[model samples]
Target: MASDDEDECGYFYDDEDADEDGVAAFEDDAAPPPERRADYTGFRGGGIGAGIAADRLCGLRIFVCTPNPSSFQIRKGGRCYAGSAAITQESLYTAQKQDLSTVMNLLNIKQHQARALLIHHRWKIDGICDCFDRKGRERMLRDAGIVLQENNSLASGGSRIPVGSAKCNVCFEELPLNSVSTMDCGHCFCNDCWTEHFNTSVKSGKKQIQCMEVKCPAICDEGTVRCLLFGKYPEMAKRFDRFLLESYLEDNDSVKWCPSAPHCGRAIRVGAGERYCEVECPCGFSFCFNCAAQAHSPCPCIIWDKWNAKNTDSENIKWILNNTKSCPKCFKPIEKDGGCNLVRCKCGQYLCYLCGGPTGQEHTWSSIAGHSCNRFKEETAGKSLDTKRQQLQRYTHYCDRFKIHGGSYKVEMEKMGPAVAQRVRLLESDLNLPFAMRDGDWLTRAHRRLLVSRQVLSRSYAFAFYMFGGELRTRPADQATLGVAKNLFEDQQERLEHHVEHLSKVLNAGAPAVHQVENLSKVPVAHVPAMPEAEVVRMKQETVTLAKTVETLCGEMYKCIQDELLPLLVEPMSIAAYRPDGPDKAKELAA
Candidate 1:
């Protein structure tokens, strides 16, 4: 409900001096204008020439930094604003201190009051400040059920105690002053009754316990709640503390826990406007931040969801429809890949593929002798099988390509990745090879590009399938324009697919062999072999060139989708921008 400016202010600015509009006022009259700050550079330098070789080979820049970097910091308006820190049960207090310190410093309020405001506003400093600006200090405090009492002595467990006994409100019994606890709102109640209320609230998962007095809009003091509950209900006290600590994640919109299986116990926090982006968690799981699903882009979440559901059943149906025929003896489906129409099933029944009728064992490739069911079947008036057939064919065309490229990506990642590493080690150890040629990281980079582009190629088919097929097809007037756009998109997709495949092939090509010396008995003699430096150089160049080409094609395909094909749709859809180095790796959180 708060405006963007208010949200930005909350994350970045300290509200020490501010105007009526909630903007922070500069303390100095004459101050230099703020300079543009660089965005978070998570990847840094490679070892000198290796970096240059990588860039030249891939036709893309690669950053290599020493000591590594922390998770990419989310920057806002040229200043770093949001980022996630891993929080353990022991570090919860430390993780929460920064936000608490900011609110306390800006509002000049006590820790408990700051926490109350944060909880009420969902821990959004911007929303709190905006409310403070719009409603003034007193009204904002009142809305969050906080009452700033002047007489500190009247607060619960204060040093001062009443001289006489007091009447307990709930039980209507007179109790000694020390037996009753007074809340911040000056409402007094017997300790036993207070404990019961606090325990019930805590059990019900209520983070903010209100004062028991009717019409009193004050929250119970956390210290009082802890002190009272810790004595009798230590576990409940622990639960209450945990609830308060986790409110930082539960209440804040910008942060989310890594949705990894077995629990990664880490959260990712993005900038205010970055909810729709893809982020990789330190646990090596990359996901769409908005949907928390596997990183699927170039296909909107809605389309991806539908595609997944359809594929689950569609594959089986497709196999049945295209590849199988019912066996005459058992009425069971049997698939014939390529031998003959007269197929024998496990039940020892010979079946005709054309008609699913019983056939004799004596048959040739051309004919099941004397048995024929090739006569044209009459078509029904209302049922057009051709239209249904065409639809299935269309879906198969796209799905086949999608599965092929997707399957290839998995193979390359599993098989080629380690092989490339082994080849790089061999090249580095070869004494005849130049020192500059030893760094074969470019091969790894190219292989990564191949994998990434293949993914794009795979998902693009899904996008095309929905964009140009089915209910989303354009109207008649737009058909010609749609044809043009479709051609352009397909062209890009084809080009990207070709280059990605080429890169895969180049990276998969085995490394040059190094010869090992053989020892023959008595007098020792060593034979040295010359390295195939020229072949190595040529392979390196080819790998780099293919990688660059794949990267470029991927970029072009993404551009066509975003700028050309997507605009044709009535509804808005977006995909994450293509990253040349694969999805950005999340840095580990500092201790």
Candidate 2:
């Protein structure tokens, strides 16, 4: 029998029996000898070994095949995994039909009734089934206002038409039986009145119009609505159809429309994961699904919201508060960049920059004559001055670092990105270089990590500003502990910042030198100097090492914030999970 550790590895195979390819194929009933069985204990925990196992397990013969890559898949041991899908306007019907078909098949109901139940329950088919199991099927249908006809003869138009004229309840007018229509609920109304009601409902944007009878819970049949409005108002009928189709997104909890400017006309359906997770739309716009804003992970939605509101116009306001004073006569801000305390505004009002009071025309360089308003007559003025000074100082400290990283990111994207791409092209075209040396994917990956990590670094300053400063503070005792935690966090942040800058410097330094090729218009090819193999290998190793280091640092910083600093807060805060590859790219919806 296999030992416990071997069993934990989840593989029964022998390394010696395998071919030179290193792939151990297992037969259904063939057990390897005890001495020859592979010791796969090293693969028990996560690492390169575990990654290999995951990939290999997918190629096993027992698992069922699925064409849709985003569809949920089951491993041999019953682990379920699925990727998110992008629901576009073209695939909206197909996306909705999956649930509709499931519900219809389970309940043996028509499409209209299934849709009514789904809309009422917010498209949770599993919840509906569970309810049906707990409280019989009839009660579940009735609760969602779904009524089924027991006999065809009892339904509308099933019984013979009335021999004489019938009185319509809505219009109270006598109409021939053929001119009146009876709904599933057995409420009869004149065809004209019913058409007007359907038209009004459609115009009002009501996707599911209820029965016209007073206090009736039954939803109006979609077919009835379409037939009534198609003749007089074809456009309204089209609008009604669209409204019903879009209800899948508007009402479902697991799906959301992409929050892109100018509208991407696509919605994302998350098959798994929390609602707060971040997703990238196929249109190349990434956003936090929870708040429908640009992707800001590792920062809770609430904190991100507060940070955005606080930062808007904050730098300009702080500069005005710290570096300028209002003119005493005109009340317009005047920044004294140079000469003396005696400053003249564009409005022709001369004021003392220090005291912010009007000065006479006759004034010296150092002091404004008869404008000695610097003395604080009241203690209130002294306290106010101190408060403003502290606030300005605190804001400046955080804003300077934030702006630095933000500006660096923009510059790197605009300048270094194209430079790296060009360098990579040059290397690929060099025939003297080996295939491995020609690949520049490491540089591209490192550059992407640099961009994302720099964003996190910039936002971390904002988080620290609000977390430790006056905006949010804990008890006196907690403050001491928080100070220690803050130091630890800053240390990690500083280390990450140092490495990110180093990576940025190396990538910005430009790619390895390629042989200079001088060409003439008449020459088809130009002879170029061969790059040394050692230099090529060394450059490749350095780039790969730096990329891996940057990725590790970013992961560590995220883990530190999630595990350490956040727990110290009094109120609970949640951030989106760290995704090293960046935001989750939504797969195109399957046809």
Candidate 3:
């Protein structure tokens, strides 16, 4: 802990041991925003300032009116620090060992037994504890296919094995004691049979290989499995080892493999009860820990899934299915223009519009020649077309806005990000300016605000599509309540959108040009131009103010989402809570 005097003096130093609550030091390259503490006040209705709680503040170095602060307080937000850790390939064994150790020490059980318990409980320590409390130790262990022995020798199958000779239950052949092994369940099987069974299980992608004896509920010892297989099949033994190691990620609820393509070979583990939060891996890939999708907050996974599917190929297929009939001869989609049972395809094939079958060119209103169809089918098709058209229109409206903001976000991230960084370098490199005036944290914070706010604005459209749309099965009685909620949501969303654009404009308009030292070689040093001090001050203040405002507006939008809108749904769904710093970065666990 830092002394009070040190904190008051703004004594900043780089410390790898720094925690989420510790003051963060920035670097030249793009990095995850450091964790900060913020206090949440209950949602209050008023102007933007009234709703601006500490919880909504970004994790940037917030310099309100000056670069230096006399004193400050850090308050933790509920969603800011999700206590997640990044597990890389290097640290995978260490992490798995830690979890195994916890269970082993807690229950005084062997490593394999602990592993069985953890895998069965999905690697949730609290769940194991809860089951232990509810079912007691004996029953819980039994249920997880763990049979505890009084001593190591008993558990090792030494007592049950005969000194002379034993028959292998699997092969039904007489085998020497040296050639056979007994499992913890007292089921003895020949090495050949055991190896083949393990080989089959491993080839079939079974992680937990159980005893070969029928009706035996015990998990085979991992060490024994390895010993039996390593001599004949070294690669399969290695694979078996890999499976047990990877089980920490595959079986655990809180941990997930980073969803990066070309596989980052890293998994993230979040704190208990925080699987719903978003996290960033050390590999620079950010994702929602809950759904393993791109870091999309304010948009629930279900809505995002629906939106993605709708945008890609589903809508096009739907439009064809709903509005067009396939030509019977060419099998191409053909639209009906007007007043005809017989429709001509561009492929020179004639088809019945109502029945979508081949027909002669001559046709009456009631029937096409050689193609009689149900007249009532026209009513059903008409009604279906109307419904599909309305759905397509609504989807297009929301999707356009979603894509627009998303496109803007890409531009800002790729283009604006470099511009901001260059300006920061230009400002900080100026030896003529005062140290306090040269700090570019305000600009960085504002730009981050723009990027995050744009994301919120974009995803909110997806949320609105599902929330008030027909995807949710709402009752007629709830219609009035939903209307009021929709209006409120749209109001907040509109406010956020306005400020986000304003911030973007401010950032783009104010992006400083890098004063190149190389260009100065051609010109006299005295002729060099400099930005006025007053303008710099004004730019700082304006950017900071807008960043704070956008931060607050984002909070209110999320508040509206959680408090006003989501509860009205028939089926329960939840979104990851908004974090002003974006997703929490998963700390790399040491090997």
Candidate 4:
């Protein structure tokens, strides 16, 4: 913490913050006119002009700005600063000197409100619209009073007195004596319980992790969650530490283009990842970061003894480059643009350029008279599309948002998570809904997984569509699409059918009749654990044989689409139809 006098200026801020509150909104569609800017100019040490009430500001980050290089000087407490970017104030005063971007975040207010507070206060805030502008003053007043305060209802706490020992809210197990720790929910579950809660939350595989509280809108604090969960379960502890790695990548929307063709010639670059896990390049070129393709020409290791040695010696470099074929008589270089390896000398002698053998026209080697170009071309065809070619080029680029796979789970989640989460909450919260499923955390997670399952199934169908009846682009008619979709569903049926056989074998694997029990709690433990076997079998069946997995659901969905939706589209599509398997046809559908 800086002293009050120092905070009147500037300070170094850390990157742990997501900067969600009042940071500048990310601009995707527009870039505002630069010349329309207003001036923001001032960074100084000043006495606290007015006090801001805690409740007045929800998020605010303040920065004093100055355009001047070295003109103004302030020495109320005998301190010298180089520039506003360098300014530092001590204590609460230090925060007082933060950048406007920071100020907005700290206060959690819109620009208008921040301006309003500055005007109403009539403080020496440089960024404020000056001369007591009424609009600005009102905004400042609202912003200053907008404190971030919330009352979360999901209580978590240990048993205090009469209700026996504290139990784990998560696994429903008993908490260890004297070691119970409470979460922000104030519901005290044991360390193990909360650790599992966090692990399941992260592994439940959500883009934005939230508390277990139903309909509660609090974004759990990292510091609090970390303090509450560490040391109980080491696996969760390790993962929580790893989750912070996102901080190093400060911003999203970062991307690098493929270096190819019109630009730097098909080169690839990435800040990290090596290659795709599943797909391969069409060019038969594969590479990771450290080493992609082999070097074409070896470097000269020996040093020159004199100045004449400094000359480039293009002929030597050409030799290094392996320009094997040359005019035998003229001694000039010859490059074959398209054809094979046999060459005719300028002096009319014929020879095989690749093997330096004799050509058929009276030009002969020691034992053989002629060599054919056809065999040479055949031998080198694979190298034309080889992993490396000295003449052809390639390039690559790095961007955080640019994904290796055209299909990306990371990208899909950002678009889908919020909608899914909201839908789940709505399902759980609504009282009128007749769904029999439990309206609780685990159920919500299971629903989320179902969404992912459905999406993958759809993608697999698309892949099958491309593979079986040619591309969808060629045959997009309802009939053709359904024809391809049938195979996809069949493929899934085969997989799940296999699983059904596997689980059935488990039943007959000498476990006996004890495995068929319905309620394990109702049955004596000495008798056997019956319900777990059934539950496990049920889970597997639901994922596949029970007809809930993506493959089966996709088949049903495609059937519905064909039977219901296709009929509606068919007439209009016929009216607007163009030639099949053409770009114009694609345009009409898109339009």
**Global lDDT of each candidate:** 0.61, 0.63, 0.67, 0.31
Clashing pairs in 1: 44-63, 44-64, 44-65, 45-64
Candidate 1, residue 37: Cα displacement in angstroms equals: 31
Sliding window of 10 residues with minimal summed lDDT for model 2:
14-23
For model 4, give the RMSD to the true fold. Answer: 33.5
Query: What TM-score would you give candidate 4 relative to the actual structure?
Result: 0.22
Give me the overall lDDT of model 4. Answer: 0.31
TM-score of each: 0.63, 0.64, 0.65, 0.22
For residue 54, model 1's alpha carbon misses the true position, in angstroms, by 34
lDDT of 1 by residue, 1-591 (tens): 134223323322221111111111122322222220111111111133233223222222122222212111211223232433444544555455555655544444445677898888876655665576578666787778777643232432333333367677887778986577665566778878888889999999988888887877677767667767876897897798778878878887656777889778877655434556677777788877777778777777767776777778865466645644568788788765421234688999887654567877765323445553322123421255577665665666567666656867776666556556666766777777788877778877887787778778778877877888746744556677787887787767755655565566566554322122111222132222323899888888888887888888888877887787776677777777777865555555443
Q: Which candidate tops TM-score?
A: 3
lDDT of 4 by residue, 354-425 (tens): 344445653222223332221112234355566433211110110100111112333224433443344335
Worst 10 residues of 4 by lDDT: 582-591
Backbone clash count, each prediction separately = 4, 0, 3, 65
List ranges where model 4 is wrong by over 4 Å.
Answer: 1-193, 203-208, 246-251, 255-331, 334-591
